[model samples]
Target: MRHLIRRVALAAALLAPAMPALAQETLRLRMNGDVNTLDPISTTNFTVRNAAYLMFDTLYAMDETYQPQPQMAEGTEISEDGLTYTITLRDGLMFHDGSPVTAADAVASLERWGSVDGLGQTLFSKMESIEATDDRTLVIQLAEPWGLVLDALGKISSNVPVIMPAEQAATPASEAVQEPIGSGPYRLVPEEWVPGSVVVFEKFEDYVPRDEPPSMAAGGKIAHFDRVEAIYIPDTATAINALIAGEIDWIEEVPADMLRYFDGVDTAEAVAARQSGNSMQLVVNHLNPPFDDPLVRQALQLAVSQDDFLLAAYGDGEDRYLKCAAVFFCNGPYATDVNTDRVLERDPEAAQALLDEAGYDGTPVMLMHVSDIPTHDAYYAVLKPMLEEAGFTVEVQPSDWATVATRRASKEPVADGGWNVFFTGWGFVDQSNPMTNVYVSGACDDAWFGWACSDELQQLREDFAVAETEEERMALAEEMQRLTHDLVSYVPLGQAFPSVGIATDLEGYIESPVPFFWNLQRVE
Candidate 1:
């Protein structure tokens, strides 16, 4: 049996073509959407951020255990008063344009990022100055003691801190960079970029990998394939078929309903992509009349049914989803249900009574429906009925994800092309702590979309940052969670465990909060 199996394998190898293999080894991957922009700091879109990970490196990165680890930095020093942080860059760091990665570039990039990001804004508020002392050393001098300095520098999710040349980093945060230049493991092939079709990248042969092994977003990022293509396929069935036919190496967003199709396929495997999964949410515009009322927001929260939303996206199976009422994820460090009983109740009568008490006069709440992304569309499809059942009027304005992304930024009235609410998702890492979560930011006009501003909530978050012990931090976190639910900062609909379809011949895929393409190699 062994001799016959060996003979068959040898015959198949000899029959295969060698021209394509020798010309250029390409790894094709299918993402749910396209990389519309190259500026990592300007937008919070996951697709663009994921693509940027391949071409950019950060000062620090979060490990699998969710702790900050140095990535581009060699070491750091602190003052006795804890108000100064001195970071030194590693040796042999070179950008794609053949320029040395210097402290001036790091300072410029961080300054630009701090102008837009929620956490970066808060960090810079207390910072006296962040200046480059030498070519390889940067110093951050704080006006007071802020405990989340490292956490702000090592943020792993959207709005990642990607170091670039000083000239490129000098651009304003409101504008997007037309072309991106980085010092990561891959270099983007500008000539092969197609707007909605495919984005290509070639491995940077000059990149120097770290000595440590691969972790979540830390350690060495080894590019095993010579070329990589991120192909966009909006249709689920077509992408799945391509994976099964060996036309693509992986699919980022695999629908739960299509899990049965891969049951008999021996070459493809569909599995959970992350350990903690993602949390779905409904963000309401607090600048408008209907949602501007706290009672109205709380009433809408009462009408939400986590199970229904999870069922619509991940089906009825509990294996793919779970009910989590905490503002932070259910199983995370600061998970608490201090004031989430009303949300878990899913009571329509209680919600209707609250709406009546608030004198809601049947105003049409405009719900922005994203047509392209299936998961976000499913959320709105289930959300509209839930709000209506509790005595509120709903108008679902249907558009693609990009249109909704642009429309959500408008603060005008709903009658004037503005929006009342929209739905989106965030990874477990983004919701792990009070300071890191964008939803928890209460900086008034400077906050994330929906703009839930409250001085009390903001103070509580600042207190959480400076808390000296775990008990003190936990207490503050509980207070913040209670206040968040009471204020209805955002509606939390359970968690969804997204799955990915990958060919069995590929290996070294990292299990992270988001999909990464480093250390992945194709088997011969």
Candidate 2:
């Protein structure tokens, strides 16, 4: 009788309903590639910008309309002469470490950022001094009225002016920061990080989000998740399957061929983030050649086709990519088709003749390529045979995009670990105006990665920066675009907006060129 009672009790216990699982407020997502570092100053790519943004706050932020908005700053007072400016920090601000935010931190951050960034360097030339008058105020005295000061500070693109603690901001420009501690809403959980696997972030309880509403990178940034885990699933098929199978929450990239998979799924939805679209450009090292010769550079342009690259990178469709000739972006206000005919034309014989006139040497043209980015891989894959067919000795150097980024910075010759050409892309904000477009700046050693130098181009960009009226600025921009095509510092391949996949449960996600983890309220 006792054995029968025991069996009946065990069966009743097993049949009882399972206890409810603990309620979770975790956000699970993936990136196109692993972020290099959370260090705000060590800005390398778009993925890094989106990640570092949660850890640091800029003094000023740019809105969707490309206007500067006050963020951490109480207000900025500019002199009537536009040569002097005073900035005050918000009250009761503190870093993730519980230390008070100070003006000295802002000064140090700006000085460090100015030393490395192309636009920051430009602004620094005009900045005579950045002095901290008090614990909360910084005074920037300029040599002249620089028009792009706030724009540089508020820039949302790479090499962003992300503020950190004064001690941390003191980190060398050549070095990445050791820790991610800032006054931003999210704090890094170092213990949870698994490099090349997953990284975790937790909301800072002490964070005081601004009372303002959310906009692009500007306004109040309110964190909705208690924890965010950014997982890295390298396999393209596995990531899409994981998203579809409910194993992952979101995907920052969707391989062009798999766009149809998300059509009928009710549990998942794919929406385009960073919808401003990005354009791939060919960046060539001016330090070495056959590419060093202007004639060779121009000759390289004639043999290639943007359509070939675009069709391969994106899916089959004419609407997938725009044949953009403007380096600044075809969609922006600065766009001009002045020398587009030269870009659209494909004449290998004419290209060969130009190469002949330039006295084409058999110098090996090293094309540093990345296999990870589909578009870049597509473009370079097409460019290799095209350049070879054009009678240039081409050596395709295959590397991950991150390594390609590091290698492209070398000043040595290709034989001595330097590269002749590399691939990179930019969205609208980074290229919209002459002020932020470092590729066209022509600052010689001080220019963007490729180090293209032209004094005339420099003068033109500077003139556009200080132009008194829109008409004057537009004229200078048109001239600059025309000059860029002729210079061939970089080839504008094509343009297209890419989409990101997110769970339908995640709502209130804003449409931005840079992804934001704020203002999103979860639903069951």
Measured by TM-score, the strongest candidate is 1
Please write out the lDDT profile of model 2 over residues 388-480, one tens digit for every residue: 887888887777765775566678988888888877778877887687787788888877777788898999977876789989988998888
Candidate no. 1 TM-score: 0.92
Find the 10 residues in a row with the least total lDDT in model 1. 10-19
Model 2, stretches more than 4 Å misplaced?
Answer: 1-24
RMSD for each model, in Å, please?
5.7, 7.4
In model 2, the number of clashes is 0
How many clashes (backbone N, Cα, C below 3 Å) per candidate?
A: 0, 0
TM-score of decoy 2: 0.91
